[model samples]
Target: MAPAHRDLADIIITDELAKRASEPPDYLREKLAFRDLADDMADNPKAVLPRLVRLAMEACGAESAGISLLEHEVREFRWFGLHGALAAFEGTRTPLDYSPCGVTLQQNAPVLMKHPETVYGWIRSAGISIPEVLLVPLHLRRPAEDGGAGTLWVVGSEPGFFSLEHVRVLTELAAFSSVAIRMIQAEEVVQAALQEQEQLTREMSHRIKNLLAITDGMLRLTARTATTKEELVAKMSGRFLALANANQLVRRPFAHDTISRVGLQQLMETILKPYERVSTKGLDVALGDHAINSMALVFHELATNAAKYGALSRDEGQVSVGWSIHDDRLEVTWNESGGPRVCQPETRGFGSTLIETTVRRHNGTIRYSWLDDGLTAAIILPLSSLAR
Candidate 1:
C-alpha cells in the first residue's frame, strides 16, 4: 500500500494495538510523561507499558531499542517495541537459540557481554550491527527461590561505545523498569488478547453486514423474477461473489498491509474472468505493481458492470485497461466498445456505489461517460496515495 493510504481508517484502528513490534520503547518518554501522572501510571500498568519501555530505552543511551516477548508457540524472542531502528524489523521474530536476548531470557538472568570479535558471530547473523553489547533480562517477581526480583536488560552498540558507568546507570534504570515491565507485560497480554477478540468481533460484523446486504439483494431479485428471478438471482450472486473476491484482494488481517501494488493486467483478468466469454477479445490491460487495492476495487466493479451491461455484453466489445503516470498522479482509463449501446444506469446500484465511495475515500476522481457506442470511465488517483 502507498504510505498515504496506509493511514486509512481500517489501518488506523489496528495501528493502536500493543503488539511487541520492534521499536525503541523510550523514544516517547516526554509524551508519555506529559500524558499521565506518576500516580496514574502506578494505577494503570497497561496504560504506561509503552511509556515505561520508552523510559527504559532513554536510560540506556541506546540509539535503537526494542522489547522482546516470548511467542507462546515456539518460545522465541519476538520484538515488541523499537526506536531509531529499521522499521522492517517490526513484527519480525528471531529464533530463541539465535538471539542473545533469548539466552538471557532462558537463564532468567542478565548477560552483559561486549566482545567485538566474538559478537559478530551471533549478532551479525541477525543483521544487527553493534560494536559493543549489553544484555539485561527484565523479569517479573517470582517466589524467593526463583531469583526474587530483577529484570534483564540487553544493550548493543557499535564497538568501544559503552563504559562501565553507562552499564551501571542502565542497571539502575532497569531496577525501576523491572517492576514496570512485569506489570506492563501482564497487562499487555490481557489487552492484546482482548484486542484480538474485538478485532474478530468487528470482522465478523463486517462479514454479517455483507451477508445481510447480499441477502436483501437476493430477496429483491426473487420478488421481481416471477418469471426469471432465479436465474437473475444466480447471476447476481455470482456478481456478488466476484465483488467479494475482489474485496478479498484488498482485505488483509492488517489494513496497513492491504492495498498491495498489482499489475493492471492481473486486476482485470481476475475480475473479468466471469464475463470473458462475452467480450474481452481485443482488450489490452497492463499495469506494473503500481496499483493499490482501493483503486483496484474500483477497477474491478467497473469491469464487472461493463461485462454485464455495456461493452462486454456483445461480441464486438473490447476493453483496454491501462494507466499512465502524469505529474505524480495516475490516470487510469477504461475504454470499451463492440457491444450494444450503453444507457447510463437508471438508479445507482452496488457497482456504482463501490466505485464512487471507494474512489472518494482516497481523494480519487471517477468520471463515467456514455459514448455513442460504448462506455468509458476515467479514474484519476493521486500518485501520493499510491506511493510506497
Candidate 2:
C-alpha cells in the first residue's frame, strides 16, 4: 500500500512538471512585446522595479509582491525590490535551497505554497505569519546556456488567498522583471563606455589647449629674439611649425597621457624637413620620452637660426644631426658647413636663452662654436633624463 501511494505521488509530480514547462497562450503573446519596453527600463531599474512590484500587487490583489534576484555565488536570493506589506524586506536574503522562491526557480514555474512555514521553518521562528505564498520563476532573457535569471513572487497572509489568476499576473510580471534585469545589466555596460569616452574627450581637449599655450609662449619669445620683421616672421613660423610637428607626434591615436617619448632621430628629421633648401642628415640614437616639448623647442631655435644666418641660409649649406649614448650621458652634435662666415651674437637673445633654459631643465649642457664657415653646437644630456 505504501509503494502504491508513493508511485501515485511520483506520477502527480511528473504531471505537475509537464504543466509548469508549458507556456500559457496569454503569456506567449505578452512576452513578444517585452523587447519594445526593454530599452526604456534598462536605464532606470530603481524606478521601474518599484512600480512593477506595485502594479503586480494591484493586478493580483495580493498583500505583497517583490522581486528576488539569485546571488549564485552565495547560494541565496536577495530581495532586490518589494511592495505592499513585505516592502520592508528589501535587501533581505533567503537561502536558495530553503525558500519558496528557490523551489519555484528549481521547478522553473509558479510555486503556490500553503503554510510555507511547514517547509521554511524560519518563517515561523521569525514570528512572520505568511500562510500562503506564490512564486513565479523570473527567467532572464539570457541565452539558454546561461540558465536565465531568478524568481519574483507575491505572498499573502491568508491561506488559499492566491489562485490561478494571481499566477497569471505574476508570470507576466516575472517576464517583465527578467527583461528589466537584463536591461539594467546592459545599461551599466553602456554607461561605463560613455564615461570612458567622456574622459578621453576631456583629456584630448586639455592636451590641445596646453599645446596652444606653449605655442603662444614660443611666439612671444621668438619676437624678442628677432632683429627685424622678416627675421621675426621666419623665426616664429619655424618655431610654430616645429611645435606643430611635435604635437602631431604626441597626438597618436588613443594616447591617454600627456608625456610621450620622442625618438632622437625622428625628432630631428621632423624639425629639419621644412628647411627645403638645406641638406639634413640624422643618425639613429636611443632617447627616452621626457621633456619632449622643451627638447623640440631647443632644436627649433637652432634650426631657425640656421635657416636665417647659418648653414640652411645658403644653397651649398648642409646640416648633420646625430646623437650617441656615452658613459650614462646622451651627446647630441649639430654640425654645419658649406655656408657663409659665422659670427657669435653680441647680445643674449630669446633663442640663446631658450637653448640655455632647455639644457638646464634636463640637467644638460650646450656649447656653441662659431667657426669661420659655420656654427657647431654640441648638447650633452644626462642618461637619466634620456632613459625611457
Candidate 3:
C-alpha cells in the first residue's frame, strides 16, 4: 500500500510533459486528432476528457484508457473519464495508497508497470487484467514536480506491448487532460456566479415591493394618528429617512460571506443603540442562523415605536432586553417601564404589522403584553435553524 518510489528521486519531472527530443510517431495524424478534440472541447467541456481518453488509446495503441482523479477527501482515485475496454468501470474508485495512479503522482512522471495486477488486489478483484499500464502524472493545479493531481493511463493487453513512444503520447495527453479539468471547473464556477447574481436580483425586486407595501401602510397609520398637518409632515419626513437607513443595513452580503449570521443582541445594538435609553442582559445564548435582514428591520420598527410612545419616549423611562434558551427554541423578552400608563392601542399600526411579519418570516412567534407598568414583548425563535 505504498508508492513504488524506490530511487524515484533520480527522475526529473521538469520536462516530462514537454515534447520529446525526437519527433512523435505519426506526427501529422496525432496533430489532426488533437486539433479535432480541441474543437470538440469548446463545444462541450463535459465530454472533452472522454474524447481525449479515446485519443490516448488510439495514439498509444492501448486496449483501454482512463483518467483517474485523486479525491483527497476520501483518499481514493476515482475513474473520472474513460474509453475502450474498461469503460463499464467508469466512476469506480481505488484506494489512493494502493493505486498505480498514486505511484505515478509520487514519481511525478510516466510509470510503466508490467503485470501490476499481481501487486494490486483490487485490480484482480475487478475481474480485469492490466498486463502493462502506462500512467502519467496529470499536472492540474501544479506541475508534477510540485503537487500533481490525477493520472492519464493506458493499459495494454499483454506485457511488452507498450514502449517509449506510448509514454510520450500519454504524457502529452495527460497535460491535455489537466487543461480540460481546469476548463470544466472554471466553467462551473462562472455558471454558479451567474445563478447567484440572478437570484440576488429577483430577491431585491421582491424586497422592494414589500418595502413599498410597508411604506403605504405607514402612510395610512401616520395620517390616522397625526393631530396636525405640520406634525404629520415632520413625522413623515423622519420616518421615511429612518426606513431608508434600516433598508441599507438590512441588505445581506450574498457572496462567500453569506455564511455569516446575526444575533438579537447585536441586532439591537445595530438598530437601537443610536437612540439610547435601551439596555440588555442574559442574551449570550446561541441563536438560530436566521436571515438578519428581517430581524434587523423588526428591531428597527420596534425601536421607532418605543421612541414615539413606549419607555424610550420619556427621560425617566427604561427598556431592558433579555433572552433564555429553551429545549428547542430561544425566548427573548423586551420589557419597558417608567413611561406613561401602559395601554394597548385601539388600532394596530404598521409597526406592529412589520414586527409580526418579520418574526413569522424566521418561523418565530411574538406576543405583546400591555402590563400595568409598561409593554412587554416576548419572542421565541426556533433553535433548529442553528448553522451547525
Candidate 4:
C-alpha cells in the first residue's frame, strides 16, 4: 500500500506565514485601511476579482498576480482572474495537488515558496520560472465536503522577493473576494426569479386578449341572426358555449406547440359541432396556427349566415366545407345547397364584412356567388403567409 500523505502545514512554512502573523498590529492597520473598499466591492465579483489581483501586484511590486479557482470535478486549479506579467495565463489550468496554491488551500493559510518550478512541473512545461511565490487560501461559505474554493497568489522572479507585508495584503484581498463571490451569486438568483415572473405576466396578458377577441367575434355574429330581444338572448347563450370550448382547446399548454398555431381539424370540429344536426363536412388540408385562427373567424361568420338564411336554415339543407392545397396556395370552398332560392342582399351586412376582412388580414382572397340553389364562397390563402 502507498504511504499516507502528510498535511501541507507539516511540509513548508519557510517563516513566511509566521513572520506575517508576528506583526499583528501592522496587519490590522492594513485591514482597517481597505474595510470600506471591501464593503463597496462586495456586490460585483467581475469587477472585484480583477481589481484585487491588480492591487496585489501594484502594492507588493510583484512581477505577476493572479487568482486560481479550484475545480473539484477535474482536480485542477484554473486561473480565474489575473493581472500584471502573467495576465495571458488567465483560464489556464494547473495540477491542484502539486502546486503552491494547493499547499495554501490544504493548510487553509498563506504559504510562501522559493524556487516553485522545482516542485510544480506545470511551471517548467509552460516555460515559466518564478523564483518565489506567496499564496493565500480563500475559504468561501461552501459545504465542508466541497473542500472550499481557491487561492490568491503573487509571483516574483528573484529569490526571497516577497516579504511579510505582501502576504498580509494578499490575505486581506482574499477575504474581500470571498464576500464578493457570495454577493454576485445571490444577485444572479434574484435576477433569474424576476425574469421568470416577467415571462409569466406577458403570457397571461396575451391569453386575456385572445379571450376578448374571440368573445367580440361571437357577439357580432350572433347579433346578425336574432331579430327579437328573446332570439338574441337564446342565440348568444349557445354561441358563448361554443366559444368557451374552442378557447379551452386553443389555450391548453403543450410541449413544442405555440400560441401562433393550432390543429386545423381540431378547431373546425370544436366550432362546427353545434350545427352538426345539418350535414356539414370537409376541412382536410394542413394549415398553420395563424391561418387557423383567422380562418376560425371566417368560418364562424359563414356558418352563422347559413344557419340563419342559407342551407342550414332547413332540416333537409346541407353544407360542405373543404380545402385543397394547389401550387403554394390553399383553396377553401364552402357550399350550401337544398335550402330556399339564393339571392344577393341589397347591402353588405356585418357577417359578410367580417368574412371578407378576416380573409384579407391573412393575405388571402375570397369570392362569393349567389347561385339559384345556394351560396358558394371560395377563399385562397397563400402558403407564404403560414411559413413562419
Candidate 5:
C-alpha cells in the first residue's frame, strides 16, 4: 500500500504553486520606491529635479540627459533639469516644435532615436537638434477642468542609452507624480474660493442691516412735525434726503466694524442744527465724538425738545447735557433750571417713542423726573452693546 513516486512529486508541485499564489502583491516594494524619491526631494525642488535628471541618466546608462516641461503660457519648451554636458540646457526656453520633448508630448507617446547623426532628416525640417534622443510624455491628469493634456519629459544624450526596461519604469513613475501635482493645485483653488465667498457674505449682511436702520429713523422723524398739515408734508421730504445721506456713508468700498465715532458726532449735530436759535443764554449742550450711534440718536432728540419748550426756550433758563462711563455702563444726565414749572404730559408723541425705542435696543434704561423748576432725564446704557 505504498504511494507512487509520481503522486508525491505532483503533490509537492501543487503545494508550492498554492503557497506562491497566497503571498501578497509587492505593494511594499512600490511604497519603498516612493518614500525614497520623496525623501530625496524634501529639501529643494530645484535640486530634486536636477538630481532626478542625473539619476535618470544613470538608469539609462547614458552619457548625459536633459529634462524639459511644457510652459503653455509661452507655448514653448523649457529645460527644467539636466545632467552632464547637457546641463547648459537648464533654464533654457525654446519654441515647442524646435525641442525633442515637444514631439513626444504632441504625439502622446515615447520617442527613441537610435541613430544620433542620421535622425537629422526629420529634425532639420522641424528646426530641432538631434544627437540621440529618448523623449517620454509625463502624462498627468488635468489639474483643473481647463488644463491642457499633461506635460512632456525629454531625455536625450548619446545613442542607445535607453533600454526597454528603463523606458517602462520612467513612464510609470512620471504618470503618478504628475497626478499628485495636479491634486495639490486643485486643493489650493478650492480653498481660495471658499475664503472669498465667506468675506462677501459678511459684507452683504452688514449693508442690509444699515439700510433698515436708516429707513426706520426717517419714518419716525417725519411723523413728529406739527407746524401745519401743508408744512408737515414739506418736512417729511427733507427727512427722506437726510436718511439717504446716512445710508451712503455706511456703505462704501471698504470694511469697518461700526460707523466712525467722529462721523457719528457730526451727523448728530447736523440733525439738530435747525434748533440752535433758541434764546436761553445759560443753556449748555456738551457731547463728543466718542458717543455711539444708538446713544447719539437719543441725545439728539432730547436736545431738540429743550430748544422748543424746556430751559432753552427763554433767556433766563438753563440746561446741561453731559455723560460719563461708570462700571459696565455709561451714565448720561440732562438737567434743566430756571424754566417754567415742570408738568408731566398726558400722552406720549413721536419724539417720546423714538427716544424709548433707541435706548431699549441697546438694553439701556431711562428715567424722566419732573421737579418744581425743571425736567431731568437720566440714562444708563451697557457698554458691551456700544463699544464696537
Candidate 6:
C-alpha cells in the first residue's frame, strides 16, 4: 500500500485529506492581525500571550489553540493561554519527557501531526478529538536544547487542515510570542531583583545603627572604668575583639557566604566571655542547626553594657542568666546583684535598641527594672521561631 504518508523535512502530508481541503491563507488579513499583538506587546506584555493564542486560532481557522512552555526546573511542559474546545483544560501540566510540544522543540521546527490522540495517551485521556495539530517552536531561550523552548499550536477542525501558508502565519505568530514571553520573563527578573535589594537595604540599615550604638556604649564604659590611658586602650581592644568574634560566628546567614551552626549555649558563652563571668542556667535547648544570629548580637550588647557600667564592672558584682519554656514561649531572665547602687540611663542607647529590635523581630518582648541594688531584665520570645 506504499507508505500511507507523504512527508517533507518540516512538513508532513499524512493522507489525501489535507490536499482536498486546501484554501490558501489571506496574507493581507495576516498582516492586519499582527497589529493587535504588537500593540499588546508594547503596551502590556502579559496581556499579549492570551491574545496570541486567540489570534493563532483565528488566523489558522482552527478549533482550538494554546501555548505550552517547558519548565526546566520540574521538567514539565505546562499549558497556558488556552482557547476554544480545550479552553477548560488551562493550567494543565504534562511531562516534558513524552509530549509532542517537547518533540517540536527538540526538532527545532514546525510539526504537523495527524490524529495526535491516537499516539498520545494524554490527549485521548483528555477526551478531546483533534484531527490534526500544527505546532511551531518558540525559542524562548537560545539554542533551544538548553531547555527553554516552547510551542504555540492550533488544533485543526479536520484532517489535512494546514498548508504551507498556514505554517507561515503560525510560524510568524510563534516568533512574536517568543519575543513577548522573553520580555515578560525579563520584567519578572527585574521585579525579583528589586525586592531582594529592598530587603538587603533594610537589613544593612539595622546592622549599621546597632554597630554604632555598641561601639559608643563600649567607649563610654571603658573610659569610665579605666585607671589610665593604657588600661583604657587595652580594655577597649579586648572588648572590640570579643565583639568581632561574636559577630563573625553568626555572620554566615547574613552574608550568604558560608554555612556554620552554633548552639544556643555556645552563642551566649561566646558573647558573655568578655565580661568576668556570666553564670548560665537552663542554657541547654535543642533548637536544631537553624541558629538566630540576632540573638548573639542581643547577648553581646547586654553583656558589654554590664562590663562597662552594670554589675559586672564591680569586684563583687554578679550576673546570672536563666530561662524557662512555657508552652510555645521562651522567657529569659537576667539578674544583677552585689554591685553599686543602680539607676537606669536617662537616654536609650544602641544596646537597648539592639535588645528591643532583636526581641521584636521574633515577635518577642523585653522589659527592664532598675532596682535599688541591681538591674533586672526579662525577655520573652516565641519558642516556635527559636526552634526553627
TM-score of 2: 0.48
Compare candidates 4 and 6 on lDDT and give the better one.
Answer: 6
Q: What would the per-residue lDDT of candidate 4 be over residues 25-141, giving only the tens digit for each residue?
A: 365555654775576575455577777778778777788998898888999989976887788888998877888877778777788776665555677678676667888887677
lDDT scores for all predictions? 0.56, 0.70, 0.74, 0.71, 0.55, 0.75
Better lDDT candidate (4, 5)? 4
Q: Supply candidate 5's per-residue lDDT for 307.
A: 59
Choose the strongest candidate by lDDT: 6
lDDT of 5 by residue, 1-388 (tens): 2121222122111122222222233456556766766775554333455555555666555666655666778877666666666566567666666444555565566655533223223334444343345666664454344233334343445333345555555565566446544554566576666765676567658656864765566566655645577765664454444444444434323243333333433544455455553222221223222233444456556765675678767777777655666786767677877777768888876667777877887788899998877789998877666644
Report the lDDT of model 4 for residue 295: 63
Ranking by lDDT: 6, 3, 4, 2, 1, 5
Model 3, residue 223: C-alpha shift (Å): 2.2
For all predicted structures, in order, the TM-scores are: 0.40, 0.48, 0.78, 0.51, 0.40, 0.64
- Per-residue lDDT tens digits for candidate 2, residues 1-388, read 1121122123222223224433334555445445434544755674677777776776666788888888889988888778888778788888988777777776776776655654456665665656566787876654355553677777776654666666777777787777677777778777777776786688668766867777677678877766899988876776677777766666433333333456767777777677765444444554543455667788888887888888889888988777777897888888889878988888888888878987887899999999988999999988787653
Q: Please identify which of the two predictions, 1 or 3, would achieve the higher lDDT against the true structure.
A: 3
Clashing pairs in 6: 18-160
Question: What local lDDT does model 2 show for residue 115?
Answer: 57
Error of 3 at 251 (Å): 5.2
RMSD of 4: 8.8
Expressed as tens digits, the lDDT of each residue in 1-388 for candidate 1 is 1121211122111121223133344436545554563555578755454555555556666655556655547756666655555335656666666556655555554444443223334444555554344555654555244332323343445434444544455554555555666666777777777776677677558656755664565456445533575766654665566556555554335333233445445556677676664333222333322233454556666776777787777777777666777787777777887768878868777557766876776678899889877888888877666552
Q: Predict model 5's lDDT versus the native.
A: 0.55
Candidate 4, residue 173: lDDT: 80
